[model samples]
Target chain A: MPIQAITPDYHGEVRDRLENFHGNQLVYVGWDRHLLFCSAVAFPLAPDTRFAQLRDEAMAGVFGLHPEWAQVDWGRVSWLLDGEPFEPMLDRPLNEQGIGHKSLLRMQTPDLKGFQSAGV
Target chain B: MAAKKLNIKDKYRLLTRDLDWEFSYQDRKEAFPYEEFEGIKITDWSKWEDPFRLTMDAYWKYQAEKEKKLYAIFDAFAQNNGHLNISDPRYANALKIFLTGVSPLEYQAFQGFAHTGRQFGGVGARIACQMQSIDELRHVQTQIHAMSHYNKFFDGFQDWSHMHDRVWYLSVPKSFFDDARSAGPFEYLVAISFSFEYVLTNLLFVPFMSGAAYNGDMATVTFGFSAQSDEARHMTLGLEVIKFLLEQHEDNVPIVQKWIDKWFWRGTRLLSIVAMMMDYMLPNKVMSWKEAWEVYFEEAGGSLFKDLARYGIRMPKYAETTEKEKEHVSHQAWWIFYNYGQAAGFHTWIPTDKELDWLSEKYPETFDKYYRPRWELARQMEAEGKRFYNPGLPQLCNCCQIPMGFTEMDDPTQIAYRQTVYNGERYHFCSDGCHDIFVDEPEKYVQSWLPVHQIFQGNCGGPGVEDVLRDYYRMNVGADNLDIKGSPDEQRWNAWKGVA
Candidate 1:
């Protein structure tokens, strides 16, 4: 339903527009079933930043603390982009792969069922 | 013959209801412009019942008496060194959360009730709102005075008003009140008075006040006792408002129901902070968050909805979801705080062994299976000279403004992520309730000053987390945040107790 308001044309200014981030867009990454990290970690990344740089450089710092981080094979890990299954071209920039601002990327490790299968 | 003396009820009617003059020179629609915009139909203003009958003179006298008693207790608590009498220094962290997150909300309630008091067409509701407005003002003042003694010795209590506007976690309570205040007058009453004060106020007050009494904090407990009568009046006003709206016109039922649904969900999400305080922060336990929900919400709220059934009102949407969520929300909330301790205003710690055992016993079904191992790992990491803190900022829900840390109730392990694209931008929510609220009023939520997004956009003070925490949030840095185990608060408590 449309909002019941005093005025008919009640348009609010969106505060977190992509332009507000100084050329970088917000991207969220969640390791599926890994409750240890609590929520998805949000990162500000340029559209031209390659997927490999995100995978190798940024993700290691966020997900490396888990005991199972080292054992997971990136090639075999399945991925979901904004809730739909997707395959990212590793060498390509994020925008080319259709990952936009505030897009969520969920990575699932099939065999590594999070530390004793408890999801932590 | 002398004029007959007036009784309390006659005096109340003479002073309050009789004082409202009819609009002889101006249009009634012009006088109350916002009444029709929200789609509520009021057939007659005269149908509104006076919720509380206290006239101005009586109201002032009653409040002044409560103030005298309350301030006397506050003075004695300070002179007696009450800070030293708490069950544990960790109990102080709960007070920090209350002072920063909850006290400002009382001020917002004051502003909301004051504005609504002027906008209402019914004089009875207007007077009721006016009295509640003053009560809210007094509540905030008394709350701050009660907690002022803690500010001298505590780290996080120093810059609370500044931090409430800038901090990441404090935005949860801020946005809740902001959403209600910006709404129309009738919606504001249903959102705050009925949904929050009537339905969920017990979940907040009972635990915090009882916890204060159990933990030996006389100042907070006295303030709680002083505010008790006012809260009862506010709650009675809430019930009267709902019943009056429902009985006045049949068209008003669906609108009021929608407000109840939206605000009840918002109230539960905001109370996630209190859930953590009850289960983990208190040195002496009151009851588990799950148990409190059963007694206060399921039992008490169940009876309330049953009474409203004749008006075609049903239980609030997502109440079933809230029932399943109570077991896990406290654990999940504390875990998020523990992970981001460095950025928070209050200190966090791994729960002591006795506390862990207590949690295990309280949550028999899920604790050992899911949460116990995580705490064990944190404890092991601490012992091995490696204290873990999440380096990255958490993604926040667009509606609630809380970090999207809550997980699916059934799965318990998978994070519950919900999103929708509106006007070419993606918005996220922690649950369906929050998502539905945004979908209903995307314009209102779109303007949210989400702290994480602001930090990443360079709109917060600086680029780094520490810069934002120290400069933007005005936190005392090393003194205010991080683990409580080795904190200056703990050390001071130990010294006061003469422990080497």
Candidate 2:
């Protein structure tokens, strides 16, 4: 027998709740364990800005801690979604790279020299 | 280029209902490969309620706002030297447990939802899983951000991702998530979303958040409050999934029951860490672990199961024994951590005099009669400058990966042990609940990365203790573990108070 998944009737309070969702998600930028920046800025699902640009933006306000991060050669650092690196420049808009709301752009220096050429 | 005017109901319908397409180009089974074989019978795809009915636009908008507020609080707390503002240095261990044991599980749940979001036949269920996938990832980031301030001031907060993988005690949670992740999607939902989230999450999250408030860890309280609202929706999803499964077909009831039985035991074992953290680790107690369990699990959960009785679901197997264990499990787990602190990343100390008096008051049934005398001897040993460390590795339960420190139900003095032979190798469990899980799925469990066995096999750094703790676990002795008299954190706390 074929499987059939049924969606329940949506009216009344369920419909109302569905219509007005209160839990909106944020885009997070991080270096190691620190959350450098999380913004209400809703870049399009397919963003025009490059991942390299986002890294610079992460260092924008918190000059106290972020200047050191700037000196650390972020080009050598790989942008990660679970733990694996994705080349966000090639994938231009983050949506093209499977990056979405609540997705973490973890910065790690996996292979210092290898990442430099990968970005190039 | 203009803001589109769309009704919420119409947008939800467009996103969920209109998006689904029947597979005409390939076999449906080939397209969504893993949903079956777990024996859950879903007859009508429409019966599944997408409880949140959340669209990407709304999801991103609302969650972004909440996270912006949360990060602002994180910044304010960090700028003000919030670590120094905490009630006691010892209270940081609660956050340590959160980072090590709990945060990684959210990442695991993130992966689980990602898999289910793709695999489920129902569009509504798929959308829900997709949204929760994002929620779990946000939890991992927010929590790490919230606790990152302590990494500057405290030891044991560093190298947690490494420690979570290699440490002996940390294996318990790692192995639990591994168990859930390895299963089929429906079983994963049953194991985590229902059993862990619906039934037992309160026991883990609420008291710790309350403990954070009482202890003045504002960063934790902020993150906890942020996560709590999301958890309410997740809890509803859990209930909705279970009811949908049971109502879809009569055949699903027994399958659902078996999952409930297995996962409830699995999830309860996982919560032993929370129990100990509540009863012993919190410097300013919110309530005893027993009170929290009674209020959260027995009172609330009992009523939840009673409501589901009409669907042929009963409370989990071994419910009575689990209730009886409330008085004892926290002490046993904490005793293990206290004695074995050298092996762990966090500091552990015997309760102070006032704290012991509090334990005695809270646990009038079991503390003085059974646990206090052991502490008295430990105190004597500490006094004589013979600080006890277990020189030998402990025998770990094959299933739960907790040490065989749990006591017998009737005797309370004798250790509880259950063993089964599968393929000529004897495996032991700390309780019948674990033993039952192993027997039911021997093929799945026999391959468990039992940390003790790995040590004997020389997979963990090297044969020496120093090599394991230093090279493999990446933990420093004087800084990362309990010195009782003073570690850097302790010295800082004292120095801040003008103590010489």
Candidate 3:
């Protein structure tokens, strides 16, 4: 399984500084004690790349912040893709038509069995 | 090339050109991630209402106006001896951290939106992302201009862009945001846009303004307050996301529920610091962690989560624990700052007896037992004029990255421990997820170069508090917070706020 990442188009030596952290390390930044964001720089050859997967999984995490992806230019974006560079869709950005919003991940498949609600 | 200037309304029309395209590669099902969670039924994505209704034009128009207002104030603050207008510089330390750690994140949000604007599938989402993409960039630029005054007064700030990369505590936020940016578009929205903006924005902005109001930092307060007004709109976007997702498909319910859980925990864990800052850090104060929790999470998110329960999302998984743990996390983060502020980029001092009484009232259950006995001991040490730093590295939580102040849920006081053998050496964590991340790849997380440990290693200024504070973080002998003047950003605040 290859690493999938969406590096944003940001400048400044800050990104360069992240690259300076040795191989495969988690770095955190905060506003006072509140953690504003987090990421781990990992090498692919390193085993058990769940962080890689979790990182990819975070894409759907910001659903409301960005409900549509087609309006902006995606070409300029850059992020570590599995420690190398691999865009989600190399030729086609993920936001184009034909991708139904419902077609995303299988969110709640109606278990009717497993999960239990509290106030019931 | 300067993207040709067009009115924001016309700007949308220009960008909306050649609007039709075909999706041929993968089935629609394989594309978006959170289609179904519990039982959400989505009849329409078009129904999603951006409360901002912000086309690029109105966005820029209002945005430009906002900046114009900021600049008028900015020029005056800089010219009118505004730095002298404040109560003390201790108040500015909070602003310094904001400039370093948070302002950069605003820019990061802008970048996330730029990527999201291009990656999302719907026109509404794309436009919204583009709007946010632009708004966040404006925020970053404005905040930097506002706080640049401190460049003349503070030390560590000058190198923050450099420090955010290599610094230890910074990894918490860097990894958190990058986690969202690398994930699918919807998850990014849920994590960064929704949970952070809608549910928790007030937690961040409210205190900063109050802190400013408390301190004589009127300019800082004014800018922060003006900016937070925009946050109301962002929060709407967040609320809209959860609502729209739950309404979309039954399948979306469980998925959105999972997101609510994952994001809620992630955001809450990160905000432990905010809890501390709000309750303890400011020289003056506002509501306590308990009070803010009651209003924001319990009243707002607490109820919001229940409403979503109608859609089967249930409150965030960590809700029960978070509500309980606030007692501890709030005290711990502040104590860390209060105890270790010498090594950090900021300053901390022993809480006055008055402040301690407030903490006991605010935190109630935990403060007297778990934290204060030790704080009193420290106060004794300081009275004896002897401060204490542990001789060696105390264990660090692999996930949250604080020295493992965490314990099992049932017994909040027990030190939670999980360990693994890495390179034939033992590593530790307070939770399973952190242990998993560390064990999965030790090379990635090890050598976090925590600020306290750096001083111990002699990698920072020799060994003493003075040396470390002055050399590394750019503090001086007399410049520490305790020695500062005029009511710790509180007395002047009363003058400015008109409330005694």
In order, the interface RMSDs are 1.1, 22.9, 17.5
Which residue pairs in model 1 clash with each other? Answer: none
Best by lDDT: 1
Candidate with more favorable, higher TM-score: 1 or 2: 1
Candidate 3 DockQ score? Answer: 0.02
Segments of candidate 1 deviating more than 4 angstroms: B1-6
Per TM-score, the best of the predicted structures is 1
Worst 10 residues of 2 chain B by lDDT: B386-395
TM-score, candidate 2, chain B alone: 0.98
Q: Give lDDT per model, in order.
A: 0.92, 0.75, 0.57
**Each candidate's fnat, in order?**
0.83, 0.00, 0.01
Q: Enumerate clash totals for all models, in the order shown.
A: 0, 19, 81
List the candidate 2 regions with Cα displacement exceeding 4 Å: A1-120, B1-3
Q: Once model 3 is optimally superposed onto the true structure by TM-score, how far is the C-alpha of residue B76 displaced, in angstroms?
A: 2.0
Per-residue lDDT tens digits for candidate 1, residues A48-69, read 9999888877888889888889
Better of 2 and 3 by DockQ: 3
> Chain B alone, model 3: TM-score?
0.80
For candidate 3 chain B, the 10 contiguous residues with the lowest summed lDDT are B479-488
**Best DockQ among the predictions, by candidate number:** 1
Q: Report the lDDT of model 3 for residue B271.
A: 77
Q: Which stretches of candidate 3 lie over 4 Å from their true place?
A: A1-120, B1-47, B407-412, B418-428, B431-500
